[model samples]
Target: MAFAAACAAVLAAGTAPASAQAEPALTYIWPVHGTIVDHFRPPAHEYGPGNRGLEFATQPGSSFWAAARGVVSFAGPVGGRLHVTVSHPDGLRVSYSGVAGIGVKRGERVHQGQLLGTTADRLHVGVRRGEVYLDPVLIFDGDASTGVRPPLSRPRLVPASTSVYRLQLRWLHSGAGIAVL
Candidate 1:
């Protein structure tokens, strides 16, 4: 009787369905082809202690790719740079800022590594999971193995739903804010 009960229990646990035990892990690709100069630092600028993001120091007109597949939520000018943000279905958001111009629009679907925009020395990039913003460096898997040690550490993530912060950008080229949404 004991052996039968143990076997039943194991079967029940294993057959419950894999979806219930799955955790969503959203990963993004490198937004631009430039080397990472400035990483996501919450306190590096005037955004106070919890504004996390990265700045890609690249040349002007370099293509910016979608880090992951997502839906474009907000695409416009902020801090004098062309910015585009894609909200994934898994509750993660990826942002591309400091670009020369945007190729995606609000409410459009974007694939992984899709052409979203172009970056420059002034381009800023970021990723957020739920209300918590993560260090952009943590998502890059090849950096440490490739002998490129990132200077940033994993921050104690805080709720980012209310933290609608902005980066004070230095533009690479002048442009106006135009949108489809």
Candidate 2:
């Protein structure tokens, strides 16, 4: 009987939810160290082509972060995209574009609210799936300290790009690409 009881306890512990075992993931980070110039805008079409993600106003070399935890399915330079694509465990996929010196190769694991990439100072962001494009603010948790809200119509101050830039350098130094975690 004691053995059975111990087995039950072990099963219970093993099946615990991730949130119960780990700290909650940050839902969003300041896209750039500047006020949000534009808000997350959904595609204009009821069922046609349109913007899929949110847009923030930033200058060249601005840093961007992952809104949540996910696997880095692809990270490299496109013709002009120079983007990173993260696939969340929750079936959500986030993409960051308009970056340069593309860091973080494909197949890496990234934590929530971690730096994804940096972009040229004055660029707009676009996100999309097959046909359903939505606003990015919908996925971000607004912070009063930043003074930005959902349906953001103006700008909000963000943090400096230094921290993420340092992290990116470390990633690039690893050399070996195609990570799983």
Candidate 3:
């Protein structure tokens, strides 16, 4: 019947072939272990005076890391202060300012927790999704008070055979009382 065919089509569209499925969203970690000295404060207008990112109070020469796996988009001085920026796969650009010792270079691929540079007395971290700046506190998954990000969670993988069987079982149990084609 058309109704059954429509239902089957809808169900089929819900589950893509495993190879076509997207990977899980990337989880971000803290770039450095330090106490948060300042939080994000959005400006009233463009070029207005307001802190666009989080500031951490850390010891000079303390190592900082990439928040997530990404390519180094920039590593150089900005306004006389050293800075490093990583462009993530999710289109996020994370910038670390006030760094003293640089380790990664521009266009280089970096993994999560990989050392990018060392910070000075304070570290300024900024995140941007395109041109709009985002708060780093909300991006990283961890406790801001402890200044440590926990390990990333492992994704559960389901075998193709078992997944298909489970989907068929679900369809049958839905009271349609019809076997999937």
Best by TM-score: 3
* lDDT of each residue in 9-33, candidate 1, tens digit only: 9999778576677655655456666
Which residue pairs in candidate 2 have backbone atoms (N, alpha carbon, C) closer than 3 angstroms, thus clashing?
Answer: 35-156, 36-155, 36-156, 58-121, 59-121, 60-120, 60-121, 107-179, 109-181
TM-score of 1: 0.59
The lowest-lDDT stretch of 10 consecutive residues in candidate 1 is 165-174
- How many clashes in each structure? 3, 9, 0
Which pairs of residues clash in candidate 3, taking residues 3 or more apart in a chain or in different chains?
none
CA-only RMSD, every prediction: 14.2, 10.5, 16.7
Instruction: Please tell me which model should have the higher lDDT, number 1 or number 2.
Output: 1
TM-score-wise, the better of 1 and 3 is: 3
In model 1, what are the clashing residue pairs, if there are any?
A: 29-67, 40-53, 131-160
Writing each residue's lDDT as its tens digit, candidate 2 over 1-181 gives 9999999999997897877676554465435454556656554567655455555557777667666677887787678567788776655577776675455667888776566677775444443444455455555565323645565454444443686567767776767753322
Worst 10 residues of 2 by lDDT: 122-131
- State the lDDT of candidate 3 residue by residue for 1-181, as single tens digits: 9999999999999989998989777868778878888989989998999999999999999889988899999999988999999999888899999899999899999988888989999999998987898777766874433656444453322223466788789778878777655
**Alpha-carbon deviation at 112 in model 3, angstroms:** 0.2
lDDT value for candidate 1?
0.68
